[model samples]
Target: MTKPRGRGRPKGGTDSRSRILAAAIEEFGERGYEGATIRSIAARAGVDSALVHHYFGTKADLFADAADVPLRPDVVVPIILSGPRDEVGERIVRYVLESFERDDVRRRGVMLLRTAVGGKVGSPLIIGFLTRELLPRVARRLDVPDAELRAELVASQIAGMLMIRYVLGVKPIADAPIDELVARVGPTIQRYLFD
Candidate 1:
């Protein structure tokens, strides 16, 4: 007679969801959003692809769950755009800095940055996320000529700042107080977006 199978994930015990998420993170980090498939994630997690689907509805959903940061673009975009146009840069900078204050959030941000900067695997994912989710929203709100270019410039600045501050852990930029950093960087971002 055939043996009865266990009820949970064969490799990671009962926390299959966590395993899937962790695997998703690794897969996404290594292969990026488009390159990392549910099959690959499931294989990495040592579970069936169906299990991945069961845990997360789709690849986008998996990314959302895996990234697991409070600073979701959908939510933050509206907030940043809602404020006065002149102050939008300040708001964006402050929001990004404030989000990194939390240890977990900071770690996730680092993972994303590492993946994005590493090259082909993660770059497109980050760029797509920024361009699709954030740039369009900000650009639409600005309603200015070359809005797309301005948005891309803003994205570049933010990505560079994050790399310097959190990923590389460079001095001054990394060590400075959030408010001071924001003050120093906010206007530059403002100029990128508005000027």
Candidate 2:
């Protein structure tokens, strides 16, 4: 792991990696993943672009860490699999809703969809994260052979809702609470698991 140098800037040089990550999140969130670039992240960090590469192997690595996700496949896979089989929709919804409510991920999640709409630069990283982390975890718990496709479909609905409701300020859907949101969307998700 390159680990993103942050040892000498905070507390008189104690946590530069975290500082860079925070900055990256803001840049990516504001500019869209494709619009956000290594040079830009480095420019925002007030550090060398090489430093960014040193800490994060590639833009994909930086995006994953900056998104404040659990990072490792081992770490994230368990969280997805740890939830109840039947209530997966509720669990996934709550998890994402809570993440969107966070200062760290709120904008990134929103930006993810906005960028995903048309841009072509950073889609691979986000897609890779879903296939590698999210889908695999869901697949392991699901007995169905098309578990991967199901997981992706489930995520698409959830992600679209969040983008429309929270990011795009789409009415009605945005105002819907957790239970209502799940009620409206859960059955479709549930069917994916068993049907």
Candidate 3:
């Protein structure tokens, strides 16, 4: 008897997801989100278009999977939701710094920052990330009335820091010690977290 067609993702696959993820990152890095297409990513991965679709439902889904921050939504969402607004500043700052400091963080952070700079508007990958992934976590943590603005502010602050510290390698901040950098910037982040 002929084998029945596999539904969803096919079995006996090894690292297909990783291949798609790596290819997606390269595509987004080079093409920006708006310009990156499933076809292009599939080509880069040497997989059929259907495989890409089967692995990840859409480009945004692919991004979330690839850039998957490993931020425990279960833990994060509740922390933000339960914490007092005043304390959000510190929590958000600490959370972001810790997240970015990781090795994997740089890979995904760079991709996100590139998309931001490239102005990948209409890219839900970034938008949903900022709003659904990042913001609500921040907004819930803070007690500020302007949670929306605060969330955006947090993104702006991190983006600027990444640009100077990681991306451009600006003079003073370039080689600053992580502790010193956090010490100096932490308070400001605290303010944003609390304010």
Using TM-score as the measure, the top candidate is 1
lDDT of 1 by residue, 4-45 (tens): 767665754457787788788777655656678999989888
Writing each residue's lDDT as its tens digit, candidate 2 over 84-141 gives: 7777666667766766777656766665665555367557657777877777887887
Instruction: Judge candidate 1 at residue 56 and give its lDDT.
Output: 89
Question: Against the true structure, what is every candidate's RMSD?
Answer: 7.0, 5.9, 7.0
Q: What is the lDDT of residue 138 in candidate 2?
A: 75
- How do the residues 1-195 of candidate 3 rate in per-residue lDDT, one tens digit apiece? 975654455332656667778888778766778789999998887778788889899988886676665556657757644666545445655666667778667667777777767764435556777778777776775567888786687678867887787666687887776666666665676676554
Best candidate, lDDT-wise? 1
Could you give the candidate ranking by TM-score, starting with the highest? 1, 2, 3
Global lDDT of model 2 = 0.72
Instruction: Flag regions of model 2 displaced more than 4 Å.
Output: 1-20, 34-68, 71-85, 114-118
Residue clash pairs of candidate 2? 4-55, 6-16, 6-17, 7-13, 8-13, 9-13
Residue 156 miss distance in model 2 (angstroms): 1.5
